[model samples]
Structures are given as C-alpha cells and as structure tokens.
Target: MTLDARSLIKAYFAEGTLPGLPDGHFIGGRIVANSDGDRLESYDPGNGQAFARFGAGKGEDVSRAVEAAQQGLAAWRDTPPATRCQVLNRAAALIRERSDYFAVVEAVDSGKTLAEARGDARSCIRLFEYYAGIADKLEGRSIPLGSGLTSWTEREPVGITAQIIPWNYPSSTFVRGVAPALAAGCAVVAKPAETTPFTALLLAQWLHEAGVPAGAVNVVTGLGSDAGAPLVRHPSIAHVTFTGSVATGVGVMQAVAPNVTQLTLELGGKSPLVALADCDVDKAVEGALWAIFSNAGQICSAGSRLVVERSIHAEMMEKLVARTRTLKLGHGLKDPDVGAINSRQHLDRIARHVEAARGRGCSILTGGSATHDPASNSGWFFEPTIIDNLAPSDPAIQQEIFGPVLSVQVVDGEEEALAMANATEFALVAGIYTGDIGKALRLARSIDAGQVTINDYWAGGIEVPFGGNRKSGFGREKGIEGIDAYVRTKAITIRH
Candidate 1:
C-alpha cells in the first residue's frame, strides 16, 4: 500500500504522543513538560520537505535525562535477569506492533527506501529479541585460586551509558546500541543524529509501554554538540558508545578524557571487496553493488573499494557497471529499490568525492551524479556512483567517501589483492569472492579487518560480532562479545 505524506505523519505521531506514554518524557525516563520547549523538523530526504518535528534539548535536558536514568539504574540492576528478559521480550512485541509506523517514520526521516526501512524496523525487533534471550545468559566463570580463599567473578553493569548513534540505519543502530546495554543492566542516554531522531524517539515510546523503568532508556534529540557532547562528558556517565565518522569518534574520545570512562567506538571504514578470478563475475558484481550502495553507502562497513584480480578485472568491471546502472534511484518512500541520500550535506560529500576521483584520472563507468527532481531530490539523494581505474593509493580510494560511489582497482594476484585490500588505513571489514574455499578462508584470515566475509560481501547476522581491527575503531557491536562491551568484570575473594 502506498503511504501518502499526511497518512504517513498520522501513522507515526497519530493523533498525539504514543498512548499511555507520558506526554513529554525522555526515553531514559525524565519528565520535562515545562523544560524549555524547542523542536527540530525531520525532513523527507526525497524532497527536503519537513515531515515531523522532534523536541530539541540541552544541558538542562541532559541533567533531567541523567537524573531519570540514575533514579532507575539501581532497581533495574537489582531486577532479576529473568525479569529484564521479560521486559525486553515485551518491548520487542511492542516494537513489532508498531513496525509500520516506525517504517514510515524511518523511511521519510532518513530517506531510506520503504522496503529497506521496514527491514530495518524488523531488525530492531530482532535485536531486542536476541538481547532478551541473552539477558539471562550473561555469565561469568569461577577462577581457581590455590588457597583457603574463595574467589569468583561477576559481570556487572558499568552504570549509565551514553550512546550516540548515527543517521544511517537509524532504527538498527539505535536499538543495536541500546538493547544490549539495557540487557546488561545499564541505563542509557542515547543521542541519535539530529536529522533522524523520529524512529529512536518512537522506540523510546515503545520501551515505555513495555514496562521498562521510566528512565532506563532516555533519548534527547538535538545537535551533536549540545546533546551528544553533554551526554558523553557528563561526570555520571560510566561509558560512552558511539557509531559515526572517524573524525567525530576521535573528538568524542578526546572529550571523554580524564574521566577515563569505558568506550566502545564503531567508526568509519573504506572496506574492500576482493573478487578473485575464479569467482562468478556477475554474482560478484551484484554483491559489490549491494555492499557499496545499500543505504546509499552511508554504512560504516560499506565495501566501497572493489579490488578485482587482474585476470578478471576488466570483465568484472563491465558487469559491475551494468548492474549498477540497473539500480533505480528515487523517493525511497515510494520506490521498490534504492532511495535518496540522508541529507544535502551527504549528497554534496558524495559529489565532491566523485569529482575528486575524476580529477585524479579515474573513469566514471556509470551513475556518478545527483538530481534535483522533487520525487528524487526532496531529500538527500545521490545516484549510485561507480569510479573505475583509480589507483589503490589515490586519496579517493584510501579515504572514506561515505556515499554511493564505488572505487574499483585491479590487482595482479591473490597476494596483490590482499595487499591492495590492506592499503586503506581504515580496516572495518573485507570480503573475498572466490570459488576456492581454501583461498577464500586464507584471505579472510589474513585480511586486517574486524570482520571478513568469504564468497559473500554482506555482514552476517546478530550472532556474529562486528567491529574493526585498526582505525575503524574498537569494540564489538553484536553477539556475545557485545555483552562484554557493556559490562565490567569484578573479581571478589574471601579467605576462609
């Protein structure tokens, strides 16, 4: 069913705030009805038209949020693991109940295709469910110490955490960042990117209905400087989890210094997808296109660099260009496929990268531009771009463009392919496309990335941990390892 603008807005906010949720409360549990009233408009990326407006808050807002989180932390921590699991299970149910509204809000707010937005909204439900199952399963081992002393270890919440999520994958990233922290008994003050706060706020409303303690999960919407920084720098915050650009991550790291708070940063990537000669060229091209253009390549682990063996580079490039040209770019709210960029700034950034690559002798195969049609350019939209023949060392190749532009290069052999893949300093993820299982496994192990995929370019499910090895930043975001990221191991000993 096609959702018009009026119907979409009605579906999200409905007649008013989510039923039974406090009129003006932070997701983390603060009541701010009289607190300085301010709001920001969320726009439709397809046409730059405003769809909805969310409240804007500052230090006063931060204090209210932290207080609410602080108030609820002890009870939540003391709650039975089984109880927490039940709460999360119900939260997942509530989210699923409202998935359509979330999909609509997410699609318009972030310019993601409606189908993609629905997938993300569903993924959010899965994340909550997955973490719910693991909530009661967080266990620590008993370490043997030879003596009359008895010793064991317990994994405890590290107190309140301030999670700052990015614009891309708003539903997935926000929940993925928040759910595990909640499962581990930590209250969260999440600051989602200003441009895409609707889904996060909607999730917050769902959590409230699911019986999460009033302040267990708080979301404050505003600029990163005011809202994001305050949350990170707050003295009461025990941990800071962030997902965004390397530049911003570095800044956050610097700001949180002296406090020595625990940090889990999932930063930028210029991930490479290496296609071996023996792999199917058509399939490899398809995989590469999806890897780089999904969410318009705003993903941190986008395989933006395509490294093909020289023996098949030319043929693969032909297939890649042809496949890319077939991708439809238009209003995600109405399209069956690829949609607009998240914002004007993102579209400009993609354009600049393509221009730079062209100036440096790279050839445009297809889709290297943007359009201003109301249906397509109302939001941040860039065409799926492909720049071939760029040197592996070229600035456009090494640096992250964070757009729909794909840079292709040729390598002489398997060794050369591995070498070229490692050329980029940012090593978040790498994929190997090869018919030989041994070669694929070998390269997967040897690649300097936090996660590597063999024969496929997609990052797998929640059971698999995802992060980076080098400057792509530290800390795992999924799987059992993610639980470890949210807690501190405490060893207690008693002499008998």
Candidate 2:
C-alpha cells in the first residue's frame, strides 16, 4: 500500500487525466505518429474516459517495424551470448528503478488493482532476470557419430520474432515475450493489444536506454486487423509468439501460414481447481478464492472452474461464498480487492455469460450481476461472482468466461472430479488441493493441462514453463523452454 502514490497519481493526471502518454509507434527507436493520420484513443477503464490518443497503425507501419528489426538482427545475434544477457540484467535494474511508475501506468491501462499491477511489475522484473541468468546456459549438444566424424548441434537465433501481446497482461506479456526472444539474440517486432498499448511502447524505449539497439526492439500499437495481422504475416518475421483469444489465435495461425513462420501461442483457458474430500478445506477455499478472483480472473490460467468432491461440496461453497462476499470494489488507483472491468464490451460479454448460465437453471451462490464502483460510479464493475448447480453439459462450465466468475461442479470422488475437470475444451493450468501427495501426483498425471499445481492456485513463479493444450493453443513460454521459439538448432558435422 505504500507506493509513491500521491506524486505519481498527481503527475499521471496532469495532462487532463492522461499520464505522460507515448503517442506514436516506436520504430528504429523513433516515435512515429504523423506518418499515418489514423489515430486510436485509449480509455482508462477505471474512469471510463478516453485519456490517450496514439497512432492507428496499418500494414505499412508493420512493414517499417519489420525492416527495423531485420536491420537490428545481425548485430544483436552476433554479439557474445553473455553480453546479450547483460543488457537484460540492465533492463531488469531499470524496471526496479521505475517499478512504481510502471505499476501505476499498468493499473490505469489494464484496469487491474494497483496492488495487482505492482505484483505484475515485480513479475516483469523477475521474468527479465530469469531469462538473463539462463542466456549463457542455453547450450547445444554434441552427438557422437563415430570417431572419424565429429558431430555437434548449434542453437542459433531464429532471426526476427513477432510478438502479439494481450490486453489483460500488458506489461508482463510484453516483457515475457520480448525478454526471452532478446536473450536468444533475436530482434523483435511487437504489437501490443490496442486496448493496452502504452506500457509496451514505454518498455521498448527503456530497453534502448538499457543498451538494446533501438531497431532491435520495436513496438507498434494499433487494432489487431490494422497492425497485428500484418506483423504476423510479414515474411521476414521468422517466429511469432501471441497471447489472446482462441479465435484470434486461429487467425494468427493462418496469417503465419503463407510465410510458414514458426509460431508460439498461449491462448484461452477454462482452467479447473479440483478440491478432493481429503483436502484441507480451509486451504481449498483459499486457493479457490485466489484463482478466480485474482486480477478479476482475467488471467489465461485463472482457475475459473471449481470441481469439488461431493462430501465437501456444501462446506466448500459456504466458506468460498463468505470470503468472496467480503471482497472490496473500487477504482484500480484505490487498490481495492476487485477493480474495474477492462472495457464496456468485455463487461457486456461477462454479463451475457452470467445471464445465459442463470437462464439454463444454474444456481447463483452469491453475486450474479454487475455493480459499479461505489467510489467512482463510472466504470463497469462486476461483483466477484460464484455460480453453482452447474450441469455437466452447461456451457458455463465448458467455455472460458475470462472474468470474475467461478462456476462450481460437485463430484462424488477423485475419479469423477478428474473426468469433470477434463470435460472442458481447454487444458491450460489445473490446481489440485489435497493433503495426499501420492493422490495429487496420480491426479496430475491424468489431467490434460500444460501445467498442474498441487495445493495452491498459482504455484509457480517465472521459472516454470507454461502453455496449454487442445483449444488453448500450442508452444511454450517462460523458463528454459521459452527461448525455444526464438531459436533453432542446426546440426553440423566435421570430417577429418
């Protein structure tokens, strides 16, 4: 709660409710705003007001960014691996220096609470640090093919990479993709989600100050059709890492198809949190609350589905509801327990999902409607909701709601719980809260998610590899495997 709040907030609101906003695409280290007259206005969801005007990029802007990255590729890739890592270490230090300001901007643009945004800023710093530490450790292996010939593999940079960041996690996603790509010595052309574009551009500028060449990192902000699509399709972009909806991810897949660009997509999730009868009920309730309520449940891996054992069903609901009802709501600047929804359209989407579930005879446990922040009374604020009495066939249980909604499904035992959990189309992350480690391991093996957590909702930090299966999209990000998308292995043999 003790951030540099007063002065930062005062400075942010100086330009008529807008912060020191960056208003143009950052290409070759320069801010280009006047090249295209089309502009996009960014609104602060906390106040439901337009506070920024930036460029609305077209295919042409994406082309310029691609050219800049191509020019920056050789110098970056040829630099000693250790030197490349030192730049990220410097960037991490810069992030720590600017953490307070970055957190404030992130909270404003993404509609997450200031506390949550601060956590994200810390996560960003750790992401860069983690990748930087491992840059030199990314080694190629030698294969023995008899004594006469020496054979070894070289891990080389995958040239220019295209990153399409999402609105939910603006800053962290930008760092998450860019950090690893740069560590792999690949120049990057990134397009931040139009809704939350400012922080990424600012981060790009900071990277230059941290010694990354200006052309080595470019941020183009615009609509997905206008800028994102073009960046994905550019032939020079050797790898593309995107995080967003399944529908949009599918489009990215197709766009990269003609060029056959290598892709890494971290998409949607209807992730489950399974609470078995033998689990510690108190811990299960705590995990359920954090999983569905954190960041207003906007994360790709948010445990939105609660699969509870039949014996503990009533007790679990009682505790979950009591804790959920106590959650506070206010503007993100105020750092309440729950903050504003990202946009009116997303708010409407959340409302429609709840209405559809209620219509299908699902029982509402506590909250099932939208409520405004009592303080500001302007932005869209949905009460943290918990829906119960879900039928197995309920769309509410199957689809990714991507909001502050947790739907509960009661199961007789572990067998039924596993079956019900895997019933969804997504396989992102799963949490199993049980005292029995052997039982948890057995259940984990059976779950289809990319990552599984035992006892906690968000169990790992930046070091864990994360992604999803089935409709959640493919390829991995974070940890050692994260750099895989930005690098390719070349096998070389020497004959004596």
Candidate 3:
C-alpha cells in the first residue's frame, strides 16, 4: 500500500489538533479571494477578550459574491415554494433543538444574558417559521388597468440581494431579513455586524444542515468599508436591504445609486410614547419604561421620547423616576434583570447624551451613572436613566441615542403632544396611551409612521408590515408585504 506522508499525518493527528477548522469565513457559497482579505477579532463587550476572528473582505470580493449569487439564483428560484418552506421550517426546528448552545455563544460574544439570548434565539426561529408559512402566499395582484388587454400580474424574484445587519440584534435581524428573501426565491449575501458574527456563523451552519442549497445564502463577516461597500456597489446585486444607523444607511444608498438597485433601509428613530390625561398614570409609566429600556433601548422602534400631558406630567414623572431607580445594571450573565451595554462605544454614546442633556438644563430625575460593582467592572454597562423637562428640539428628543436613556417632554394638550411626536425626522413607530376611542383612532391615523399602537409597544413581528416613512427608509420586512421587497411585478397579457 502506497500512502502519502500528508495523508498519514492527517489521519494520525487531525483528530486531536493538526488541521484545525477555519475560525470563520464565507458560507453557503464559493468565496472569491481578494488581496485585501484581512482578519478582524470580535471582542466580548463584557470581558474585552477576543473570542473569534472573522474574515474581512475588500472591493473585489463583492464582485465574486455577486457572481456566486447569480449562479445560485436559478436553482433557488426554480425550487418549489413548498420545498423552500420545508427547508426554512427545518432550520427553525434545528434552532429550537440547539437553542441553549446558540444562547451561550450569543451571550459570550454579544454580551446579552443567557435568558435574553435564549429569547433572541427563539425569536429567530419564530421569524423563520413565519416567513416560511408565507412562502406560497406571495403573489402579484391582477392589475385592473381599464385600457389594458387582459392583465395578470406575476411576481418574479430579483437576482441577488445584499443585506447588512447591525450589532444590536444581529441574530434576529439576520433571520427576519434573510428568511423572507429566501422564501421569495432570491439568493443573498449577508453582512452581519462585525461585533457579533459568531451567532450568525453558527446560524449559517444550521442552514446548511437544514438542506438549504449551497451558494443560495452566504455570510461575509467583515468591516463595512471592505465587505459592505463592495457588496452594495456590485453591479450584479439587484437589491440592498439594511438595518443600522442612519449615517451608514445613507452611505449604502449612495453606493447602490449607481446600479439603480432597489433598497430597503430600516434605520434609526426617536420614537415617542404619549400619555393622555385620561389614561392611567401608573400603566403609562410601566409601559413607557419597558418601551425605553427593553433590550437596553437598542431597538429602532423603542419609545424613547415620553410626551405626557401637562395635567398629569408631574405625577407620571414621579412614577417613572421611581421605576428607573429600581433598575439594576451589571454583567449580563450575573444579572437576571439588566444586561451589559452592547459595547464600549455604546456606553460612551450614552454618557455623551446624558452630559449634553444636563448642559441643556434637563433634570436627571433618576439614574445617570454606570454601575461600580467590582464584579461587573470589566463589562460596558450603564443604568437605566430618566431625564425630564426637555423641549421638543432637544437633541435627546430628536436624535437616536441607542441606549437605555429616556427623555420626558411636557405638552399642554392632545394637539401639542401630536405636534411634538411628529416633529422628529423619523416616522418608524409611535404609541398612544389613551382611554378615548376617537382620540386613539385620530392619533393613529395622523401619526407619520408605518405602524402605531394605541395601547401596546411591539413592532417588527411576523404578522405586521414593518417599515418607516420619510428618513426612516423604505421597504417593509415581514408579513406578506415583505415578500414584495425581494421580487418585481410583471403584467402578462394574452389574446387568442
């Protein structure tokens, strides 16, 4: 028997350590190498230790990814909708089966608590299931063009999509955004936030095991300048879907402009939660606190702006301040209530907002400093803070802080509250807590947002079409409308 020396050594020692698996890189498709292929280390915000190193791409790699995506398009589009649904459902099931593993990886890498990470994992699975159920229901409507030869509309998949996710909710965003694109039969190249790529990498592995075709989905873990810019500017990429800061979204839009690519941007917001005088002050306070501090106020649609009627403003502010004082901030793993800040940069941003608000004469009702516990000193963390007596034009009311900070503004009446809420540049989401049905309906209809809740505060779910007007960016994700973002409509006419 003639055996190569390399093969013999591999058989002997590979099991132990010799040929270690690659740390992290592209998945589900062929990776086209570029000269600028660099490595970036993802650090745990809690411990500041490098947990994983992922590949960073350059300009040329984008072209290669686009080509690979084009190649996969035919196979993915030709796949029966039912089969695609089955594959997606299988991935969802696998997510549930290995929920704990993903939760641990997410907590260590992203600085979320195990419980919150588990919830994020479960939400990802539910997102996949939701989109999978709608795979067969995506249809183009029949256009009733009065002067047309009998017109029937067909929805056709766009060729290739470039989707960029943010670090705050990387897992949920990836699953929510990608599942709909796949269900619509479009191939995708995903650019997860560089800070949290481990969970996304693991998700790609599960997708392969779930029987998703190779090259149908790809992940490039890298910096925006290298990987993201290339993906956006690639000529073959038909669409761009992004969820991040407004500044980044603007850059993406500029890059894709040359190609005339369809774009969907779910960007930043300073959403408002209004409390009418007729509403219960305690209930409003509880709802407002959860809205502002859930997920550390990292959500785009979170009601960070509290616009309350002046009649009950003092009482409501007292209750809100009391609640804020009760919040505990520490290492996510060690605490059951609040988690560590997402990163050091985020902590700095929150501090700046507090300083600026104080400079502008806003009162710090309660909670303004980071936790000083020796055990959690290593983690980037901050307390849930409340600031009252701010004008509508205050920076805290206009800009998205993306942290656990809420600013309270007093309004004279219903009309003034509505005016203040509509003053922000973003129209992603707003909430109204009112007892009067007429007032609730009026506010809901008048608010300049994609979705409004009369008494609730949840957005970006499976059933609702979530997007924004004005600068909040266009295109809906989730629901039947989400499928429309990945496909184009064509009218077909036949005459005998």
User: Clashes in each model (backbone N, CA, C under 3 Å)?
Assistant: 16, 0, 1
TM-score of model 3 (CA atoms): 0.91
Please rank every candidate by TM-score, starting with the best.
Answer: 2, 1, 3
Every model's TM-score? 0.94, 0.97, 0.91
Task: For residues 1-496, write the lDDT of model 1, one tens digit per residue.
Answer: 2444447655544442222222343645544542577777767777777765667777788888898899778778888999989999998888777676667667777888888888897888888999999899888788788889789989899999998989998879988878899899998888889888767777887787787888888888788987888889999999999999888999989988979988999998999999999998888988998999888888899989999888898888777787887877777656645878888888887888888777767788887777654443345667788888778678878889988888888888899898899998898999989999988888988889999998778858877898996789999988878877788989998888
| Model 2 agreement with the true structure over 1-496: per-residue lDDT tens digits | 2347667777665653545668899999778873578898888887788877888999999988888998888778887889988999999998888888788888888889999999988988999999998778778899989979999999999999999999999999999999999998999999998889988988898898898886999999999988888889898999999999999899989989999989998999999899999999999999999899998888899999999998999999999999999999887888699888898899889999999988877899888888788876788788899999687888889888889999999999889999998998899999999989988999999999999999988889899999999999898888888888888899999998
lDDT value, candidate 2, whole model: 0.89
Q: Model 2, 215: alpha-carbon shift in Å?
A: 0.8
Q: Sum up the clashes in candidate 1.
A: 16
| Model 2 deviation from the true structure expressed as Cα RMSD, one decimal place | 1.7
State which candidate has the highest lDDT. Answer: 2
Q: Once superposed on the true structure, which residue ranges of model 2 sit more than 4 Å away at CA? A: 1-3, 11-18
Comparing 1 and 3 on TM-score, the stronger one: 1
Question: What TM-score does candidate 2 get on C-alpha atoms?
Answer: 0.97
